[model samples]
Target: SALNLQLMSLTLFDVFGAALGVFVVLTVCKFVEEELSNINMPEMKGKEGRFQYTITDVKITELNLTHADLQFIPEVGLLFDVQNSSITLSFHRRILYWFFYDTGNINASAEGVNINTILNLIRDDDGRLKINNITCDARIDKMKAQFSGTLGRVYDFLASFLTSGMRFLLNQRICPALNHAALVHVNSMLETIPVRTEVDQYIGIDYSLIDDPVVTSRSLDMNFRGMFFDLSHQNDTLVNYAVDPVIREYDRMVYLALSEFFFDSGMFSYFTAGIFQMDIVNEKMPKDLEMLLRTTYFGAIMMLNPALVEAPLSLQLAVNSPPKTSIKTSGATVVMTAIVKVMVLPPGQPPVQLSSMTMVYTHIHTSFFYFFRILLDFFDSNIFKIFSNQSALESLALIPLQAPLKTMLQMSVVPLINNWTKRGVQIPLADGMDFIEEVVEYHNGFIVIGANLHFSKGLREMISVMPPPHMAVYVEPTEALPYDSDITD
Candidate 1:
């Protein structure tokens, strides 16, 4: 869709080097360890005059990635340096002679191994991240081969040759194992980022990337199609009329900016899905409110029929249009326009509409945005304005209904909408990571959210292998950014 192209100017995430460093320490290291756990090594055979032996069923069963460091290579890519790792393998060794032969299992291990690799990052055609190239160098400091059989002593005599040849073979496999992990497993993990996912029954959200990530000395900027769509009508998109949100600071782990369209589209989806409507009748309506409704519509009920006077009263509220949001440096203001229809339902008959009035709901968030709220006359002037009849006399008669109707909406309708929104929409993030200490600031036509990140697990939970001494990570304390700085009304 052209939605990404249209909203390409808006940034979705401004990830700093600090956040990326945590991700590498928490996720990539453990993942690579798991991916390189098992590697089958080719068989080796050697003959020298009367002494001959063949190694079969060779496999590296244990791998421990002890240390990993990531560095940015300016315009090139990321350099991955791994140190002090170890690999253990099991194999069947057979000794053959002119007339005598012996067979036994042997365990071999190599420690103090180091792997250096460069990972080239790129954006694929599908707008997903890809590692286009990987160049790896491996080094093994020491290798040990333990042999056991009836002729264990004889095998020990040739340990140097056995360990040397096997070390070379093991060195050959390191790059391929790392290559598979980066290109296949690591890239597969990136696919979990949501492109089009249903947030609830009525609406869906798109976190699809708009363009390739921009890498700089301090941060990585990514643009996305941050739009919500109606489930029943997926093709509809609210055009982004608001100014693009700007990222001014690079102090936090990440900064997320949302223009007004980011929120308007969510309201549009709910409106289009018919979720912005409610019907209150019978026990749901308060006794005093019902008394007011009956008293106000007494003349209309009498005109319809004397029997209709005892009919049950119903208050129906429906949003007339999509809600609009305004953002300023202080905070945000959300305004919604809805129409309320007063009606009555009689036994074995269709409900009859008695009267309808348009109501605008506005909530002031802060003093700075409160001033601009007055500037939008089209939204502010209609606050509680009511229209009941064509004649001036009929309009005067409906004056009693005005205050009560608005009060009922403020009490019931607003909370009903809030309860639905409280369920919270699912964000597009890798499992176990969540945002914390979020601070919102309003700008003209847009909003920004600056927040740090946290993981559900500590260092032990983050990795299956033993904890590394270099990084003993614990939960980060909540640290909010400066107020009056971010996104969404």
Candidate 2:
């Protein structure tokens, strides 16, 4: 019951995606098998000329389902709906005959008997394939006969019997066997598909919801989650990246969509993990700043605030909006804006909060090399000041520290920002597949992306060369009776 509930909650898209691949290979096979098996007629006998008839086997030499149309029902998920599908199949029947007066015995065979039909495919309540209907106006195109000995006029009866018996068989057996086989085959296939894949040491894809697929006239969509973990580091805070939104589609076989949220714990683990402190004794002034400080009173006054050699730095990252993702010809891109706050604790004084600064980070990742590159397009720090409360020192310095202070502040913090941007985050977009075409950012938080997979020519050729499903008869041998003569002796 628990397992059933779990499957019920899963998205239908994952099952459909995997099933589609298997369906392509089995479509023709199933079609032809149904066509041949439909010719199941009860045995017929005529005392006038002793004869025995039976279909030894049925084989489908040709089949085609590529032109079939697709249909979807959102209520039932992505059920397989096909119409006007056709097939060309052939089979064989064996026969035995004798003269009216037992003058001679005959053994014969019929080969190359052809059949054609149109098929309709559907799904049952259990999510298995069901062949609802089949329509065909076909007959045995050609039949080869191998005869040992035949009585006169018996040939006419044999031909008439073959025709009538085949027609009667088609009326009785084809639909039922076809429906049964389809259901069993599809259910078996569903068990083989994998619901999740580990991309690497740090990330994995969760396709558990893929069974609840969404389809429309445009394309198919499925929901999945990305599992991200940092094995080496332990943090008390956890980030929640689960966001639901209505994702829009643009083009391609865009099947998979995901939404990710950001958390402080995740950001801290990614960007900062060590003590960051700056003090007067430990601070190394820039060459130009140091030169200016020695030459002017303004630099002399700056020294009074004291270097942050012992001050402990506190870092906070605040996201203004959820990151937006989209696909480009090169690879996937994430555009986001964040405010970085830095606080310093001065010796014998309360902690001082620096000015709040905002930065827009645009990340471009390439599918080919799997490299992450971030571009800082905008930085807003209009009210940024290093020592805003030190007005007395500023008056004594004889010059305003706004311009020089801004330069010093930029020099101090920009490198740390750059280092975090360069080496902090990485997403392997092309982990297992050949390439990802594009990613779409939704109005909500969901992200839609299309994946491109490559199949080898050899594999395609092997599937084409495979023989269609066939029905064969195997009779068990009867056991010999015990010798009664030995017991009498």
Candidate 3:
């Protein structure tokens, strides 16, 4: 029980500049700037002696994230430092000048923004990424305003008082807006990661976190359930009985290690759901193979039906059990037991079985390393190219169907399985995040995938150009932006 039975481990290595920076500069960080821009500042009202006035319709009209940097706080979470940003806003000003009332519009602008946020990350009770709390500190450096619509000279006199009040009120709204977005909106996005979800009608996957993520000075490590279930039979789950997958290398942006349990569970689910069965008809089979099938089953067909001898041949294959995945330093192998049936179908009649054969189809699973399969050799069906150092399959089938059956499997059933697996499984990722530069390394009983992470365009594209990560730019909590950080930043 004390052993670390981690089936899958995901790591964000210590030096997370590219993807993380891009994400901060593109998605979440960009979202922060937007939250600041969309801030709904409260109205400002004051009375100077007999002159009283109110500033309403207070809203930011423009903002820019000139320069932003993200840093880890060791024991804490992330610190988003938003620097020198440009912001602009507009408001409706109504003044009661000793009973003589007048209304006008005041457009305000500020330069050199100052905002910092701390986001605390933790695993929730349900095993999803959760934001514990968010602390935001924000302000506007220097704000100025222009008045119009009936207040010419009077607007000049009240500019200092009016701008100061608007700037302070706007500053007060910044933290709440940013904090709400992180705790509510951004957390909602993280929640999109499936804890346990149906992959397809036949099977389901559980990517629930095994424990709280380990945050250290070097990296962030997360362990996951990495299990699957047969949807047809809810309890048809493969035990997490494989060796723990270990991640020793932290050279990439993301490092993923999956135990045999992660892959075996899926194979088991499909097998239990009866999805590992396929019927290859002559139409999809090659001409030469179809001819060989016809000749090979001719005698059996004659014995079954005297008049219906020219029926089209069909090869049905079903994996008899869940595939066993074995991984070693040399490579990995998928050992499977399958029953293949040779049949002939008359025009409208049901399939008439000719000869039933058991194929221990063993071929190298590409993902688990280059070890071979089990059904191919046991069925006396010698197919698939042998890899370096692996033993060759000894052909022992005297039925003169080994080569043809091999061809038939490759041509028809293989594609079917590929399509089925494509739709029934996924690599457990949320929207816009993808795995890249993936390198699969096989160990004793598990696989480690070293990869770089890629995040897509954030927010939307704008025509404005942004400086580099180190180059201080500008940020404002004022309005909508016209720049796409993913473009040039």
lDDT of each: 0.67, 0.38, 0.67
Tens-digit per-residue lDDT, 1-489, candidate 1: 447543423222333246554574545666566655655566777774677888889877777777777665556666777899888878899888788899998888988889899887777676666677899999887788888889887778666667777776666666777786666555555665567788778888877776666655545567777788998999987777777667886655667777767777888888899888999988878778888767665545555687678889888888889888787776667788777777778878998877776666775554322211111111222256566534466567777877776677666665677665545555566556666666656678776666676767542233333223233232322322211113111
Native RMSD of candidate 3 (Å): 9.8
lDDT of 2: 0.38
Better of 1 and 2 by TM-score: 1
How would you order the candidates by TM-score, starting with the best?
1, 3, 2
lDDT of each residue in 1-489, candidate 2, tens digit only:
111121111121232234444543354445444444344334333322456555434443444443332234443323333333333434343445542332232233323333334344443343323344444443333332322344435455554444434333442344445444343333333323333444333322222442334444444444333332233443222444344534444343333443333222223333233312233222444556545443465334334566643355443445555444544345445554555444555778886654344545555543312222112211223433333233554433434444664565456644654343333323322222233344433333333444333323222233334343234222222322211222110
Residue 129, candidate 1: Cα error in Å is: 4.0
Measured by C-alpha RMSD in angstroms, how accurate is candidate 1?
Answer: 12.6
- TM-score of each model, in listed order: 0.73, 0.43, 0.72
Cα lDDT tens digits, model 3, 152-236, are 5765767766666666666667787777666666566666667888877777777778677777666778898777788778765
Off by over 4 Å in 3: 1-4, 13-16, 84-86, 96-103, 140-160, 248-252, 278-318, 327-332, 340-358, 365-400, 429-445, 448-489
In terms of lDDT, the poorest run of 10 residues in model 2 is 1-10
